[model samples]
Target chain A: MSKKNALQTVPCESCPLRKLDTLREFDEDELAFVKTFKHGELTIGPGAPIVMEESNSPHLYTVLQGLAFRYKTLPDGRRQILNYAMPGDLVGLQSSVFDAMNHGVEALTDMLLCVFPRDRLWSLYTKRPSLAFDVTWLAAREEQLLDEHLLTVGRRTALERVAFVIWHLYRRGRSVGLVTANKIVLPLTQQHLADTLGLSLVHTNKTLKKLRATGCIAWADRVLEIRDQDKLLEIAQMEDTEEARRPFI
Target chain B: MSKKNALQTVPCESCPLRKLDTLREFDEDELAFVKTFKHGELTIGPGAPIVMEESNSPHLYTVLQGLAFRYKTLPDGRRQILNYAMPGDLVGLQSSVFDAMNHGVEALTDMLLCVFPRDRLWSLYTKRPSLAFDVTWLAAREEQLLDEHLLTVGRRTALERVAFVIWHLYRRGRSVGLVTANKIVLPLTQQHLADTLGLSLVHTNKTLKKLRATGCIAWADRVLEIRDQDKLLEIAQMEDTEEARRPFI
Candidate 1:
């Protein structure tokens, strides 16, 4: 991509961040400082590791295109995906606090990222306290989402959990204008969804079948189409209130 | 207890956190400003809810004494404890971005809290940017801990998960000078522990027995005493890196 196109594809404008007002409130000079960031792409086939476990070097990555999964492997070789990073989603915010990553991130497709050097970002935060505040708010928001994930893994039934995950992803995609009312490009397999949800592959398959039977969602050609958005929300136990879909700061 | 005695009981002077230098960097006026905070108590007897789901309250709470857990109840009556908040820990920091809470916090003991209203805190941040930095750093540290917990729940076995939880609690207690090297007080019961770890009660019980049999921990009088910290860490697959223990800023 040309430099101009690369800058346009940075996904910053479309990010549904809760604290965009704070970011936009930045002075021209401050915005210019952030605008200096460069972007890059990594052409990795399926199953290529994007970030390794216990690595000292860390870089903040914002997805420009394609999919990636953050996961860790147990001693017995079982893997659990922490989450999936999609377009406009930023990763490595936690790595900013820690010196090393405890888990690994692997690309499930050829990926593109707007990469920021960790030290430079830290320097920016030191010079621009407002940026630091924005970053902190973003991390706090991530924590809130993790809290919800803990609930899904701990209490929700396999079907409810799966429904919840799908609904969450759909809502997030919709917020970024990546999805319509009923259609979303899921791009994740039953196994990938299973790993993310902490469920067995068979269980994930069964849950998807159940949802399909109920006309809550349909799966074909690597896309998930929500057949009944209202019913899906009810199954996920999500409120129609603004609170349920509020953007994280 | 007298105010002075209560402050003494907190052992602020002896805290490793005091050696972190962040607080020491504060000027006299800043120190005096924070010292002016009045200590208070929040009592919610066992099973009393502290923060309810879908309720909007703009306050951040610092635990003064006692234990509390954040949880969400499912439609089928299943509950998952998202986290256990201890003394000196923060609760509801992320809720400031939202108009309502998606999860509920309830006391395991009659809880005591140092409540900071969000508006007042934000005003303070505007005036004393450095204090805001410190508070944001503290919130970031909590996010790091939550990330580690996510790894444990997503990847580790039931036995390893329980062991890691206990080990983490022990380490946190040590950081706060609440425990010695080998002895620690565990205030939560196995059932409560099970809920937090996303394990069945029977599975949690079996795991505890296994740990006891391995001579890594001893459970008596509702307390878990670590006999071999190294062995416990090994079983938990935890890295003993300084970064893991440090309060990240």
Candidate 2:
């Protein structure tokens, strides 16, 4: 099946998560209990706001297809992308900490999302502590990602930062079976990449040009294709650990 | 007893942690069981390395006196200070994830630390699941701090970043009863401050000079004193929230 069709096949009752090894730790009854959760799909077009700032809506979302970026806008209208979410990844996990979101989430492309109500999730956690633990673990992982991003923003060079991001996206794609060898398609704009890296648009474009000039990567048709994976990885200064790779698969 | 004298009174058998309200959530037997494990204290001098990189010694430490910086150094000798640990704070909680430290921790002053072996702590967790949950919660709290730091590094200016650091240190000091109404002492050096903020030493000094000129804060002789906290808070762009303050108290 095509990627789009495969994602559409994902339903609340027949979610592939039930068969995943990560959920194998849950017993038959626990699985059935979670399966009872209500699910709804949200399709967000490019540049559309998925979760608005200060919105008290308490639905937790999981990315089913396409990509989304979470960001906060400054008073001057500049944006800072806090994180990027991909398929099978959970977003809005921190919403549990507050009554409303302090940041906004926007779809980077036409996307699909599976959402669950916070109240129902809390009730499920109360009955199955293991599920709660899993949720907490997911939050912890997000925290780790934030820490790594801090290091990148604070210390890495512009080229290194861009390479790190591309390497990261490539690794995530590889794990989700969207990548073949070192080549992967990245559907992000230079402006969005700059926001995520905390760099200016001009600097981001310059860095990408350098990467392409050095025969490191190719960017065309809004898709990024890594050419020299080893050279790019070295420039990115990424630690080749299993944990650094995506966890979805 | 004065705070300094309180430091010398090492009543391992009667540590206040046994009576802490958070631990009270555990049963009496569990408290006694945890207390039976001997606590060892280690003193580290300024610039002394406390934890080595990539060495997997499994022991969790609690700061009893003085200060330390958690950092990861790159091959080129660029260091990023992840966070600072003060009295009553737990360090090395990430040791649960591996056998060796991915980062190195060093003493910023002559420091005293209370050590708990990983095996003993793991045993305690097995016996009391609540204890494990509490540790996880602490880890989660650490993650939140990292997230805030990420935001600081990603978007905030050099001056704003320093102000945020000072504000955070002052708030932490107040939470642990180390601060009075309007004054707090910061134990970090400008050089260390630069490392933490990912700025050059000269830039950090320039920022400090600016804050000093504005009479927002004062730093000398390794002590940072907040002069006008309201102004500093405003400059730091800190949100006034109960959750931003420590919840343990």
Candidate 3:
């Protein structure tokens, strides 16, 4: 499928993410430049490839709707999910800088992405330091999440891993308005969980069953509901850091 | 202990890392700007911290010499070593961008770090898009390494984890001129390995014994020697990617 869209549509000032307190605001000139810089938006269906690995694309993206994930595959076809991309999360920033994607991004649900030209990124960096810094902040936030995931996969027990990942997703989803009250929809399967948590499918189901038995979480109809958020955090042994206002561009 | 150093002694043009093929070279103008932007150098002894979690330091760092590791600690004292920093590695880019360090960096050996003012980072972004791009590149590289570590931790078998980490360190060290032929000084203890690999000390020792029995590796006297590099890579099921010239700052 063609990754490029026909034309620019969304004006930066009225962008949906501007209403969220979670993201930092852009000044007038910055917004105008971004509006011009944004080429268009592209939508993909579930299980669609947004950015393929090893293919050099001259564009970067930001998630405008739905969910997707970044992942890598071994030579023997073993896949590992790196992290999920939610609304307002910048996609392909690493690829834009490094000039090659070491991993690929695939949509979990139907996804809409804001497209920006990779060639103009240098202009953004030179003319808009705040925006450039925001990009760095986003990359750093991603790195922090990966560090946490690495620890969870490497050190945490099976039960703790399940609890921790659920809590992590819940918090991030809530921050981005994907979660309302105690419920959030996750377009993931047992296979996704197994790959993400580094467990066998059987083990993932068993651990998830154990978590369900605690009455702290309910997962059904692709929606996960937190019945006892405190208990889950306690089980996970995690304290959420107070994240500052992040930038979405 | 203080994480501060007294004065700036080295000029940017005379920076030792510029001599290495591993790092990208800066033009004269960029070099002059960086020399003025740099605040000073700090010497940290083994086991001392370079950046502490939650502390707002006004400076970023680049490793000039020796080794260090970044990590996070649980409230109950569980520690997970995220990744190592060798010569020519940018140390505090994440923290400088995000404002609060989500993890801590500690020296694995006596180390020297070139300190740069965090406030002037915007200057680099505005005046030197290339350097700003390089900073993002460094952060992206770090994220990529973390991705690999996550996959190793979450998916690889115990023996594979052991084999992979050793190969990882050996390759990274070689790129930065820290390795000589088959030998590399790690400056890490068994406990460090246990923490880093998410294994117990006993398990770590046993795994090392198994690796040594294969006639592919030797670890003793704080130094690791590779015996058959190809055999180790085969055991790890890995291929080393050819890394391009990296930016040290």
Candidate 4:
């Protein structure tokens, strides 16, 4: 990913994510600290590598726009997509905290990120208790997602797995206004969905077709439409875990 | 689980976990705050529930000794073991931060836990930046483990899946002196292993037998003997990821 050097800084007061209804509001002083905390903005195109596994970047990021995924590759070159990063999600806490990245991240769509230096994160903790709590909240929220995904990949049937992933993306997408009227432009290939589901390409295709035939979902040209959210949840045996108010940095 | 309420406080300065070489040392002031932060001790027998899914407890815990696992269950009564908790691993942090527990935790053996009030966690962060950093580090570390397990359960062959779990447990067990001479009195059943590997009981048993025949491992009664660490890692395609110095709170 190449950096766009001409800086068009978006001031904290005018930050787009802060305007989302689902996110909690930051107080004046907290927003002031965050304004200083942000290093700059980063822009990258679809499918560009954002962070490599086993390496640390000096910066952490918050997704200002677009989709990305965190993944890992086995020795045989098989990849497992761990989870997705959406608008307002923090992208690199593991690498920033431990000084070694255990997974790689790549842009799934044309993206913009607000960058923060890793070292200054400590100062945020010492100076702002509420924001520090928010940082831990984000990390804990991530763990909760991983725990749910592990359950899905490890025990759910093929049909159930496919349904769950779509249901999750739908809700997260709705929260950030990326989706509306049961539809979103999900920047993902069927192969990417296959990798995320732990299913082979042919099997994932069959499962997707089965769901579409049931009129629960439809996919074409990278757009995902949840035709029947209730039917999808029934197959997935899952419901919304989204909090009315969510935190983001 | 029954609470044995007679007071037997293990003071923070003389805490057993603090003496471990693998853990970083806390300073006098930090130690003083921890001593006050800790409410008391908790003891539970084997097979006891430590925390329940979808419910939040007022207190959070650290495993001072013994083994436990974090897991989730499907509506059909099928289960998936997400990951294990060892000495020095923080438990219930997700619930503490988010006020919702997404997974249940159970004791694999007789366990001793250090209890801290959930409300007090915020004070720790506000008062002590280093300890707050440790809290984030612990959370990040847990996420790292989940990422690795997702890769293993999602993509590894049955044999590799079995090897990876055993190798991972072996290394973590060794860290706190729970394992010795390549053997540990493991407190898990074949069904538990099956749940962990996301394989059927019969398939899991067959894979275990195959590994046994290769002289890489031996499991009789409740004892697990890793006869060949290198051979096991080769099959698992995993190596030790333990940091030379780690943090615990």
- Per model, state how many residue pairs clash: 0, 3, 0, 0
Task: Tell me the TM-score of each prediction against the true structure.
Answer: 0.82, 0.82, 0.95, 0.97
Q: Cα deviation in Å at residue A73, candidate 4?
A: 0.6
User: In model 4, how large is the Cα lDDT of residue B49?
Assistant: 90
**Where is model 4 more than 4 Å wrong at Cα?**
A1-6, B1-6
Q: CA shift at B213, candidate 2, in angstroms?
A: 0.7
Q: What C-alpha lDDT, on a 0 to 100 scale, does residue B212 get in candidate 4? A: 93
Model 2, span B1-249: residue lDDT tens = 143334545655455443433233335665565554334667789889888777776677877677788887666777788878877667775554444567778888888777767666655444545444455556656655776676677778899889988888777666555676556666677888898898999999999899889998877875668888789878877764443422210
Model 3 ranges with Cα > 4 A deviation? A1-9, B1-6
Instruction: Please identify which of the two predictions, 2 or 3, would achieve the higher lDDT against the true structure.
Output: 3
For each candidate, report its DockQ versus the true two-chain complex: 0.45, 0.31, 0.68, 0.81
Candidate 1 vs candidate 2: the DockQ winner is 1
Per-residue alpha-carbon lDDT of candidate 3 for residues B1-249, written as tens digits (9 for 90 to 100) = 123333556667788898899788888788877876788888889989898977877778889989999998777788899999998888877767766787899998999888888888888888887788788888888999998888887777778889999999999998988788789998888788878888888998889889889999998898899999889998888986767878867
True contacts kept of each: 0.41, 0.28, 0.63, 0.74
Candidate 2's error at A115, in angstroms?
3.3
lDDT (10s digit) by residue, model 4, range B1-249: 123223646767788998789899998889988877888899999999999987888888999988999999988888999999999999999888877787999999999999988999989988988889889989988999999999999999999999999988888888887777889989899999999989999999999999999999999999999998889999998776675578988
Candidate 1 lDDT over B1-249, as tens digits, reads 255335433332333334543223546555555444323335557777778877876677777666788887776767777777777677777676555677888887776666556555544454555566566667666656666777677667888898888888877766656676568777688888888888888989998898889998898986778888788889998755442333311
DockQ of predicted model 1:
0.45
Residue A101 lDDT in model 4?
90
Sorted into a CAPRI-style docking class, model 2 comes out as: acceptable
Candidate 1's displacement at residue B98, Å, is: 2.4
Write the residue-wise lDDT of candidate 3 on A1-249 in tens digits: 133434545556778888888888888888877876787888899999988877877779988889998998777878889999998998888778877988889999998789888888878888788788788888888998998898888778999999998998889898888888789999799999989988899999999999999999999999999999889998998876655778878
Please give, for residues A1-249, the per-residue lDDT of candidate 2 as tens digits: 133334454654466444433333446766666555545567779889888876766777877678888887655566777777877677765555445577788888888787766667656554555555555456656655665677787888999999988887777666555676666667788888898888999999998888889898887886678888889878988766554322221
Model 4, span A1-249: residue lDDT tens: 123223647777888998899999999889989978888898999999889998888889999999999999998888999999999899999888887898999999999899898999999989987898889988988998898999999999999999999988888899899887889999888899989989999999999999999998899998899888888999999876665588888
When superposed on Cα atoms, how far off is each prediction in RMSD? 4.8, 5.7, 2.5, 2.4
**Could you tell me the TM-score of chain B in model 3?**
0.95
